[model samples]
Target: MQTMKLTIAGKGEGDDAPLVEDLIGQLGDFLGLLREVEDAVAEPGEENEIVWRVTGATRNSPLSIEITAFPKRHGMNIDQRERKVRAAAAHGLAEIKRAPARPDWFDDRALTKAGGIFGRVSNGLAATTIDFGNDLPPVVITSETARAAAANIVRIQKPVDRPYRELGSVEGYFEGFERDGFGRLVLRLRARLTNETAKCILQGQAAAAFEERSVGEVIERGRRLVVSGTLHHRGPGRLYQVDADRLQLLRNSGLPDVADITDPGFTGGLRSEDFLAGMRDAGSA
Candidate 1:
C-alpha cells in the first residue's frame, strides 16, 4: 500500500473560515478528479482500489483540511504498482495546473470530468495542494487553474458534425458490443498491434451477419474480427466511430514446423542461392 495527502486551505478563520458545506462539496469533487486520473493511468485489469480517509482538520486562521489516500491491491511487484499510483497522481495534478489544454496522456472523457471537478473545487478555496512526500514538489490548485479547466471543458462539449472517411479493412480482437442511443449495434474492437480501441457500427448486411453469429460466445472467447468500413474522427489520434460495411471473423494460425518453400524441389528444382542469383542477374540485365 502507498499513501498520498491532500491539504485544502481557506482564506480566513472563525466565522470567516470556509463554510463546512462548501469544503465538503469541494473535497468530494477533488476525490472524484483523483479517481478519474487513476482510471486514466491504469491499464486494463490493473487498477488499484484506493481508500481515502480524512486524517484531520484545523480551525486556525487559515482553515485547513488534510486527507490521506491509501491504495490497496494484491499482487507481486508491489513496489512497482505503488510507484505507478504515485506517478499517476503526480502527473494528474501537474496537468490540472495546465488546464483548458488537454494533455495527450489523458483521454477526452477524463479531461472533461477533471475540468468540471476543478471548476467546483476552486470555487471557494484559497489553495489546494497534493503532497506525495519523498522530496517531490506538490501540486497546487488555484482559482485560475479552475477557470482554464472550465474553458477546456466548454471547448470539448461544443457540438460539431464530422464526416466519415473510408478506413478500408481493420483487424482487431473483439472487446465487447453495445447498442447506441439510436439502437444501432456498436462493436468495441481493440487493434491487434497497437491495442488501441475503436467503435465499429454494424449496418445493413453487416448487422444481419453479426446477428446470425453467436455474439456471446465470440465475446467470451476473445475472438478476432476484421471490419471494413468508413471512419469518423474527433481529433488527432482520436477515432470516433466506424460504419462497417463488412465484418468477418479471423481464425488464428500457428507457425509451420518446416519451411517447405525453401526446398529446391518446391522452388522448381532451383536452389535458394541459384534463385536469388537468377533474380539479381535479371534485375541487372
Candidate 2:
C-alpha cells in the first residue's frame, strides 16, 4: 500500500503542499495521495487500503484518514514472473525498483535476516543463458545455424530458491521468472567484473591460462562479469563474482531444459568495459 502523512510544526491550517511535497507536486485541484509518495510498487488490481495521519488541524487537533488507490504490489509468482524479466532485458536495475516480494522455491538463501527485499540479483550469467540447443555454439556465434530461429533457443534464468538477505553481501542468482516456447513462468525459484584492477591482480599471473586474446579483451571480459545480489526489504545485499563467458553457456554442452538459476533481485555496477565491435573500432570510423 502506498501510504504517507504529515505533521505540522505549529498550530495552523495545513495545506496539501507540505503533505504532498514528498508525494505529488501541485495537484492543481484534486489532492494526490498514494502513487505520489513512493512509486516503488505498482498498483496491481484495485484500490489498496493505506493508513495515514496528519497532525495540527484547525478544527481537530490531529487528522487521521484512510486513503485508497491502486495496490502497488509489484511481485511475481511462479505462475507469473515473466513481467520482471521483460523489465530486466531493458530497464535492468530500474525495473527492480518497481516491484514487491511474493513467495519462493528453495529452502532459504537469505530471507531470515532481511524481511521483504531479496539478497542479490544473481550475477551468475553462466547460471542463466540462451541455449540454442545441442553443443552450444561459442560466445561469438558465427555459424549459419546462428539464425534467430534456432529451435534450441532457451533462456535459462529463475528466481532465488530462498528469500533471505543480509546487509552488504550478495549471492549468485538468475532471472526471477520462467518462459516457454516464448518463455513461461513454470517455477520461479531464484534465484561483476574488473578492469585496471585486473592489471593489478594479474601483474604476477602472466602464466595465467588465457585464450588467444589481448590482455585488455580478457580483462574487459572479466570486468563484464558481476556479483549477483538479491534486493531485500530488510536492507541492501551481499555480492558474489559470477563468471562472464560462463554466462552464455554452462560448458560446451547447451543447458538442458531442466537447468534452473537463483535470481534474487538487483545487480550492482561492475564498472564499464570497452566491449563489442563498436567500442574498439571507433578509430577505424
Candidate 1 collision pairs: none
Q: How close to the true structure is residue 279 of candidate 1, measured as C-alpha lDDT?
A: 88
Q: What is the per-residue lDDT of model 1 for residues 1-285, given as tens digits with 9 covering 90 to 100?
A: 344555666556544456676667667766665666565444444455665667777666555566655545444344544455566657655754664334533555556556655665567666666666564567767777767656665554452435446577776678888899999989988755334588999998778778888546456434667788887666533455689988877553333335522444655778878988998999999
TM-score of 2: 0.19
Candidate 1: minimum summed lDDT over ten consecutive residues — where? 252-261
Q: Estimate each model's TM-score.
A: 0.55, 0.19
Worst 10 residues of 2 by lDDT: 193-202
Model 1: number of backbone collisions: 0
Off by over 4 Å in 1: 1-3, 13-16, 40-48, 55-78, 96-113, 134-137, 159-173, 177-186, 190-197, 201-218, 221-231, 236-238, 242-285
The C-alpha RMSD in Å for every predicted model, in order, reads 7.8, 24.1
